[model samples]
Target chain A: MNYPNGQKKIISKQATSWQSKKSFSNRGMSLEDDINTTNQFYLDIDRAVIHKKPTPVQIVNVHYPRRSAAVITEAYFKQASTTDYNGLYRGKYVDFEAKETKNKTIFPLANIHEHQINHMKSIVEHEGICFLLIRFAAHEETYYMQAEKLFPYWYDKLHGGRKSIPYEKIKLDGFHIPLQYQARVDYLSVIDKLYF
Target chain B: MNYPNGQKKIISKQATSWQSKKSFSNRGMSLEDDINTTNQFYLDIDRAVIHKKPTPVQIVNVHYPRRSAAVITEAYFKQASTTDYNGLYRGKYVDFEAKETKNKTIFPLANIHEHQINHMKSIVEHEGICFLLIRFAAHEETYYMQAEKLFPYWYDKLHGGRKSIPYEKIKLDGFHIPLQYQARVDYLSVIDKLYF
Candidate 1:
């Protein structure tokens, strides 16, 4: 396959075959759910250990529903200081953020926060595997773009370039994550190829 | 000073004098407030960057109060899979659970869940620093007890022993966290002495 920018796309035939067999029928699985299922599979198989960080919530008002249960009556989402997924993999810390975009031609840099980029930089400096898992829903493709490729483009965007990472650039620079039967978002396969 | 068990208490006279002069005020502070202040101090001073995991809430109902804000009308506290605080310290992963006890003579083991203990064990197996910050609220004394010491006692409790860890045992096995001007918990000081 080729993009508009004339970049050759390395589409995995095996991944396409797996996607065809899978229906993802659990209340319409979101990207988060798929990643979580993948992480669980990794844990069960004793592969790379990974987990999604619990959603940060600030409790303002809580009511005692029963002796054992406390019902939160008021709360708000709090900004997370670190990326969603971070854990040790083969004696090295692996950290990454997962985001999905509906845009066919571009992946919006705005989907990622400044702090997340900084966090990824620190992880990279500390000799950890750091990257972003970008999913283009329109194309039904997921790419694992390393922090080195992301930071320069992110800075360029800050200096008034395009606000999105071109699909062609992602296709060229990123590793496509294979969707699996057990590990729904099987990102570790990409990590194993790229890092190890 | 000597306990009924005939163990000589290691009371630092200098520390006592320092505490008297400082007048450590536990009256005005809630457990949450003290922890937040301590975390801020940790971050500012570059001492063991630790943060409390945010309270997990499952939002079920929401009301649009205004165009700008959505108010959560109903939610419930989700069961936490891991302990409260975790972070990196001096290239070592640090994970711990903090609890406060009103009892003067005993710290209840029942306060800790089995899953939390298991999580701490896994952290220890991975060469991470895993411990518990236990505060005896009645005496205004806080101690950092290593998970290794905690496990045996927890098992003994399961076999019908006293449900609480005796204050004397805590004093012997755990490091007494000194109250400091900048860092309220001053746990890293104890960690340095015990681990590093």
Candidate 2:
């Protein structure tokens, strides 16, 4: 498919059915959708109260038709100053951002934002559960890197280091999140091992 | 002015600069906007962290332009299961819903959803700061009613009684939130009186 401005769209041969079925086994669906489903499952089972924060959108213009509902005619996404997910679990606040990439060698630090890093740092200082869920999509691997481990490297990146976190370094510092039938992400298992 | 429905359109007058400058003595802005501005001010001052939860919308269709941004062609408002705002304040969880009505006689319980009532109950049970900011727009009066005070009445609504909370009852039960320049709503002052 060709987009405007002469940009070519590369279509992958990934089957929709296979992706839906193996969603728990690999980084199948978009990270956001998978995490939302996982959070709902957790809520259903009374395991935790985690939730995906809704995308902040600024609605500039709204049209209210007499017979129909209100229509958001114009809106734009606002820059989020916090992590994607947060909730209370076992009397502790859990805060995290989940990201997935197709790259096999490294996870780019550019995927994380400075404001998000600062938010995580504040959460850590306040004795909250803070971490990042990084998924290596090509290898179907997911790792939970604690905020303390990522803080030093993030500061180093500011001082002219590589813009990507190497897979080997992630493997050395992060804990592998278990894949489960119910809690697909099962990040709490990693949290249990590291914090609890 | 007139609308398509053959009804005269009464334009809401915008406050002039001089009028706005004297707003601290008057009713000032809408309760929703005041709370939002107060939250932003709190964020800036490194005070209690709080935010208004985004309105949930279910997208039915989307028009993805080749070059331009994606347009939401069709969508519907989803009933929110929780309150409008929630976040941490002084290491404590704070959750609340803000509602406004021009009615002078009473505040209808119908405005409060059953799911939201249940959610507030759970939050209170978990020892969180939970309340409702009720605005009697006709009187230009705002009150902060604790969730505990409202729950019994909410549960009683299903039994047999008026399906609304009368203004006289609220005057007796709710705390009158003071209007302020910076913290417009200044609900924490009520919190200080009630909880602290």
Candidate 3:
């Protein structure tokens, strides 16, 4: 797979920094991978049950080879209706989207979809615990910000506000998630402090 | 779509009666579809926010044809790691599996997967609301039975007990969900009565 020139440069720089953090060498792994590993860790220890929703697909056709499993021959990816990760966490429905940005000053709102913002709003309205696990990759920092806190910036764009959230503001509003050996992105600890 | 002779006969009879229940005309629709529609009704009114997890698929290959959307050329169905439907209902986590049985006298244990039972067990362990929305298609009845109640029956089969739960026993232990105009399988009312 090939990334655009600018993104490719960022990837190379990320790979370089990944080497320095040799203990956590897997830092080069995508934020999604880290969270998946963390969720698996949670499940293993019976802390919380969470999972990433499968990529939605619109299957147009399938072929059942004589004795093998049916193969999807014609299909297209479908737009997801909700955020990827969601499950039960201490009796509360936990819903969130994980995203990362390379920008030093801001996290572009463009990385998030309007429907996803709306979905997060609905989850909040239903009294679920919703948030965004955003990683400022350049700073090697991940923060857990509640969905309610994000709505202002999302709606601000409609009211002629900045298109991206200033990293300084996020640092003030979001809780820094600590990284650990087994629990890669230990966001649940932040959840315990914030909600529980 | 083809079923064995005896099962096919049951399906034909089902199709015939499905047309007569014109009010619940969507009787031909799968149990999953009915619950999805019911969940939509709840969402539309801001009563709850729930969604069905997309069918999991293993994408082996994709073709990026020019500027058009990428076409999935090779993929196969994957077993889901969690329940079909889950979300927040009045500040609590609600998770459940929907399954239909053609048998008139009993609901077979084969309809429930071992992993799903374990998943439900974990949800209950975390104090979340978990249950099975079982539909007896032959009798045209649906029941909402809590997962904790199901554990004994599930374990009973593993310990050389009955392979199926009799319909009479279910009627005794499970709450019957009545069908309504817009909310076809209004299981939330049962949840309210039982959980709230």
Top DockQ hit: 3
- What is candidate 3's lDDT per residue for A1-196, written digit by digit as tens? 1211112113233323321232223366667778889999999999999999987866666776776666667667676778999998888899999888888899999989888998999898888899999888888889999999999999999789889999999999999886777889998998898887
**Model 1: per-residue lDDT, tens digit, A1-196?**
1121233334344423322223333335556767888877776665655667766754556665344455556555556777887665554466789887778999999898887887677666655678899877777778889999999999999999878899999999998876667887877777778767
Best by TM-score: 3
lDDT of each: 0.70, 0.72, 0.81
Q: Which 10 consecutive residues of model 2 chain A have the lowest summed lDDT?
A: A1-10
Question: Which of candidates 1 and 3 is the stronger one according to DockQ?
Answer: 3
The iRMS of model 1 comes to 18.1
Candidate 2 local lDDT, B56-174, one digit each (tens) = 64443445556654444444445676788876665666789988877898999999989789778767765678899998887878899999999888878989967889999999999
State candidate 3's DockQ: 0.30
DockQ of each: 0.15, 0.15, 0.30
Model 1: docking quality category: incorrect
Candidate 3 residue-wise lDDT at B188: 88
All candidates' TM-scores? 0.78, 0.79, 0.86
- Whichever of 2 and 3 has more TM-score, that candidate is 3
